[model samples]
Target chain A: MSKTLAIGPFNDAERAALSDEFSPVFLAKPDELAGLTDDQRAAATAVAYKGHHAFGAAQMDLLPNVGIVANFGVGYDAIDVHAAAARSIKVTNTPDVLNDDVADLAVAMLLMQCREMEQASAWARSGNWKSKGEYRLNRKASGGTVGIVGLGRIGREIADRLAAFKMDIHYFARSEKTTPGWQYHGDPVSLARAVDFLVIALVGGKDTENFVSAEVIEALGPRGVVVNISRGSTVDEAALLDALENGKIAGAGLDVFLNEPAIDDRFYKLDNVVIQPHQGSGTVETRAAMAKLQRDNIAAHHAGKALLTPVN
Target chain B: MSKTLAIGPFNDAERAALSDEFSPVFLAKPDELAGLTDDQRAAATAVAYKGHHAFGAAQMDLLPNVGIVANFGVGYDAIDVHAAAARSIKVTNTPDVLNDDVADLAVAMLLMQCREMEQASAWARSGNWKSKGEYRLNRKASGGTVGIVGLGRIGREIADRLAAFKMDIHYFARSEKTTPGWQYHGDPVSLARAVDFLVIALVGGKDTENFVSAEVIEALGPRGVVVNISRGSTVDEAALLDALENGKIAGAGLDVFLNEPAIDDRFYKLDNVVIQPHQGSGTVETRAAMAKLQRDNIAAHHAGKALLTPVN
Candidate 1:
């Protein structure tokens, strides 16, 4: 009888690692938890969770003895912490470890858009450069003003990298941060207006839904580019599409989208946009670290020890 | 009769700028110099050259009165500086102005390859991310060691940017430079062995035709990534392709290729390569700066003043 259920699609190596410590029952999705036999369900003392699926009270009820949910990712928006706390269930998340990878991707996406690297790379591969003369001139990325939509850990990481490129950094958070020479904006609209590139690094969920509104998109103007590495809910997709279509704004380099993998098909046809499948922390080193942290949390829970990074 | 022959396909703005100082005769190529009327040839005191066409003594002879060849780009390998100096023809090139743009592209290409962003972006756009669970895991780029070939001005710029990402900097130059904390290797193979990324920033021409040889490529090994923002001839393309095809070297992010536009078609089919069409300095702001520098040299030559950025 297993004391743990490792939910979500783990790669072969990750699954092997989990099996070493727990007599784990693997479930790729939370919906599958209800389908487990009573014996399997009753035996579970903890859940090592992954994926961006909602894990609420209904799922919690299915595994009554599952005292803790150890999430693989830093963000726990998918897991309802309040619901977990209500059921006397503890929730823990992996944080800080994946910050560099996420921050690296945000800046990479921004550079891709600013320099039009996608088109240039494609042109070279297709043997177009020889026949077509030279790749078209792109805008310079460095030495420009950049606006970050949040100043949390991930946002600060991004700002630090861009600063090395000689960029002037401006950011918006609930309140001001104490970083030297970094300008703080009270609202996102003004931040967008003052900078050439706007990067969104806000936390996911309801409060940040459409945080980058149509007015903010409009304020970004023709020379503006938006780079989003956070959840898709942070930006208004409709307004962003309109701005890109009409050339109201220059371009965007997006990692996450609303209903991703099933993202807006219009993004496919746009040359101005560089769309990446939400892969901020998809690097092998980072993923391995995330998986290890998640396993460590579950190990702690099973031992009746304090969780390494508890959420609720 | 023109006092200057703008010997490349100049844009409307660039041509207008040239006309401000000289009786500009616009030629899209250097070969067209042979077709010029005697009076037009005799009137030309300076040539504002662009493109990668060989402007040897043969081309120089077409304009007997030409005193200066003011090349648009920093690299004057095509201009044959020794040939120009032999004919008592002064050579000047636009340098330093394009350094930041090239450095930015080099780092961007490295990030794109490390994250496998091209395929990931395509998957998101193709609606595969929705159907498929997630993008494949890729290697981490930040906090790794990077080796620079020929740590000149542009190499220094690339090193500075990568350092901000917490990357360890290593380089090979004729003589070790005085950069603090950056390790200098006396040999190319040692440099390649020491770092995950090998960036080529060597000056072009016969002396550097195959500076990154098969030995260095082999030394880089399977985990190594090669980023070339220098001239294509700087690397042994055949050895590079073989390594990439055999999985001997992990991948390449190349901005330059031998016979570019007509480069090896094998590169097109390779998923492990990021082929950029030699657009290192192909940014609007940088190109404008380069054009200004080229014009400044031309202006200096006509005024019997010393050249602004003289090569000989």
Candidate 2:
């Protein structure tokens, strides 16, 4: 077996662990792979991948012996699975490990938004509560209607947590699920129309690009809050921003966004929105689990065993 | 029958509803009662009270015919229940109605604190995610050990919601109840020692003041978070602030403080602490429910019926 290439800027501990197991060559970016000598390229048979940097055929071609790409996150959108499959290369992603963290974040954002906790916290943090009297009463989050855009694993987890708060769970999926007491709407618009919160948990790909459209956003109306823990591509960012700017919708709690790290400047100006740095799975415990799963798949590939969570 | 007095700064709708049913004399402060004529004071048979100002026997004596003191909130520590009982005055408080909102806030605050949502939100808002890399990984909130200081109505609600997240629930109450699967500790220190999060849901009063003392705070150890949604008096605020400041404990999610609105300024300096303006039940729906319940109790007192949620 050839040596492994560890890509992306992992923490010191993760990097040390990767080096200890695989005796890997480290590269922060895929583009740097081209700079490696022919011997180094030939030695790279597997890659431990992290970050949102695109890993396509070009990068794979640089490592001629690369047989497997193990991604650190549940979503492998940045990795070209089709390209990997065509090159007889295996692809594996760490899933299920991050479901709890993402689900917790989704629930936290929804409750924080609906309850106006951000402002309430700020009011208390400042001396305003003493001078301004009690914080203004906001909406009750519990026992309200919540419509999930997709009822996949992560979505199901989100719904499960929300259900504990006595919320009415509505979901939009291609096929109805067997979850009792949960309402299933045929389309996104109908789902949006039926709920006070629209939480997006759809998988990321070309097919899901702008899955939550203008019509769906409009259907959610003024009382609705849009919470997105899935890819920003799943939502029509322009439409969502316009609605929020004009008071067409109540607010949003967004983690992922289009062109993130440099998301739309307008979002910062809106007090109704709560912005998170695409950190749904950015927890020490969850990241450790994801890293472990990624390493396990890489170890399996090296051992000539079946991949634990293969995508391609 | 004498008239009912609607005291405190009520919203227009609440005032209108109170006036529509009972001939209510509105007073923004208890001191304002002295301005009323002797006949006006004599005509007051019931009081719909709000605000944190002390309502002792002195204020109660102002209304010689006052039959019932209906408090708008669950905690009636501000009202002298002993004085009410001594004067044969019926006292009622609105409980259970606000449990859902308060519990929702407790969960929200805990998740928010453990997730480092305050810094995460600021990073995204300031466009730092683009300038900087991924936000540093924070602690996982779900599936962690949580110790409840009191297993009262609100504490039980908090525990119930946390159970949905698959947390290990341990509780400190006077006596262990018949709750299956949840571990019960006889004391606060032992409970704090075993859990990653210490959530205070004990009732506020002299008996429970500083219920979570320095010893309990120390027992929680590092990596432990303290979430208080009950009242300011339940926990030793000085000890909590010291623990947070000195990094003795991890963090805290406080909805109540020792002197809220004017709480210890030291708390404002800590990045790990999440503060709220005593907004455990400050939701429009829950507050409306509480107000309605208060009115109902006052109405019951006038009709010679039993008080709905009598405290004295």
Candidate 3:
């Protein structure tokens, strides 16, 4: 039987599932991969990777016999595809299955920001609604114009949901794709300038770093709300923080931050923003699907089947 | 001027608009209606009413000379429309203008409850995301079955939005509406049993008081989530709370309660519930439109034309 070396920080169910088939060595973190013995590293034919830590050439070179890196998430920015391709190690990601969940979070965050739902919930839960009269009126979210920063599968899903809310949709992508009645922008700044809501759904990587630049944030102006469900590296975080602090834009709804978990402390104090812990694909059902997909890719690679959902 | 006597708690914008069109007396609450001089009461031909305090026959009798009561909101459950009808005094409510806003709120609340967005936002904002590994995964909101309690305009709007989320739509109304492919239940209990999420959008009045009974909550089962954006009287609050406490139902997202502002203290402690002050139509844009419609009704009534949205 071939060994499956699984990476750290999987949930109980995920661990059980991974253990049931091709029981593998588990490393606590990417840093711990170096501590493995020669026999242990050679025994493992496949690697099941998770988390946001960078897995570059240095890390890939450690597992000489490792045939594939099955990433548990759709965003494989943390994985160096160039390094994997150079070493002939196949890289596969779980996508499409998580699109609905991610899109759902994007819409939910945007509504939370526009409707001031978190504050309203707090007000009611704290017995202030009785003492403070009615919750103060908030900005209306429906029937407003929205700009989608990407036109990928997840972005299209988000645009579809917002469309049902009677929102005018505008989008920016690598090239214009024919979508009915939705306005297409040649660039992010123009899209930001045109819509009241700017939602980032761009993919992560080097070419896309700081895709939503300071100029884009400035163009979003006072009434604009920024909702980023894409990678943190895709946007200029310093610019976003500055814009939020000065009310350069109305507020923001953010899931991904430049630094995972240990994000900028400035975000903790702002009342205007709504933050989530990159839980876009964090639902029991979706996570199970993602886990299964990651495992299936590993299973297929061992069977000499073509890699499923391969990025490189 | 026909002397439009405007009643309590109007925002500055509403007050200004009312004053410009009909410069009449402005009383702070229903209790102050008795403080008016006989001449002042007689001079008032139309009353621009606001707030939730009951406008019974007694309050109506205080201003006997008033010909019409133009309510500021869609729900006239606070007003005794039957009494007005018996007295031959016209009653009108601002309706359709607020449907979009109320529908938007309903969807926002449902998504908030399903996604555990309030807790997730708190986790990220409080630096718990850094301290902890990640926000715990929650239930998915999309692709679930939903039951709309009333298939009125607002209910239809909410169902439409949820449909785009790939939700299976089921509803209960006075009679089956000619909707495409949506399952219509003859009663609330049946609707509750058939869906994962049940949303209350019924009109507030004697007819709908305690419509979402204990039986209905029980029928929804442990996997169920209730979302109420209708009147406080529409659902049995004690029953709903009991279900939430005992885990008879999964959770709830409520905007209205039996005693709002001073809602039940138990709600403040519950982790599964999401509460909001009764702000179904509370938006700067929608409120302005509602105020304008209310004024328009009064304006039309004084001009001896048909009331725009008459309840009596």
**DockQ for each numbered candidate:** 0.81, 0.87, 0.85
How do all the candidates rank in terms of TM-score, highest first?
A: 3, 2, 1
Q: What is the per-residue lDDT of model 1 for residues A1-312, given as tens digits with 9 covering 90 to 100? A: 899998998998899999987869999899998789999898988999988889898899898888999998888888988889998999999898898899889989989998888888877766677787788899999899999999999999999999989999999999999997899999999999899899999998878999999999999899999999889999999999999999999999998888866788888889999888889999989999998999999989888888999988
Model 1 backbone overlap count: 2
DockQ, structure candidate 1: 0.81
Error of 1 at A77 (Å): 0.3
* Candidate closer to the true structure by lDDT (higher is better), 2 or 3: 2
lDDT, residue B132, model 1: 77
TM-score of chain B of each: 0.98, 0.97, 0.98
Candidate 1 C-alpha error for residue A167, in Å: 0.7
* lDDT of candidate 2 over A134-253, digit per residue (tens): 889998999999999999999999999999899999999999999977999999999999998999999998889999999999999999999999999999999999999999999999
Relative to the true structure, how large is the alpha-carbon lDDT of every model? 0.91, 0.91, 0.90
Using TM-score, give the best candidate's number.
Answer: 3
Residue A3 shift from truth in candidate 1, angstroms: 1.5
Off by over 4 Å in 1: none
lDDT string for model 3 (A37-74, tens) is: 87888778899999888898998888898889999999
Writing each residue's lDDT as its tens digit, candidate 2 over B97-205 gives 9999999999999999989998999877776788987788998988999999999999999999999898999998899897858999998999999999999998888
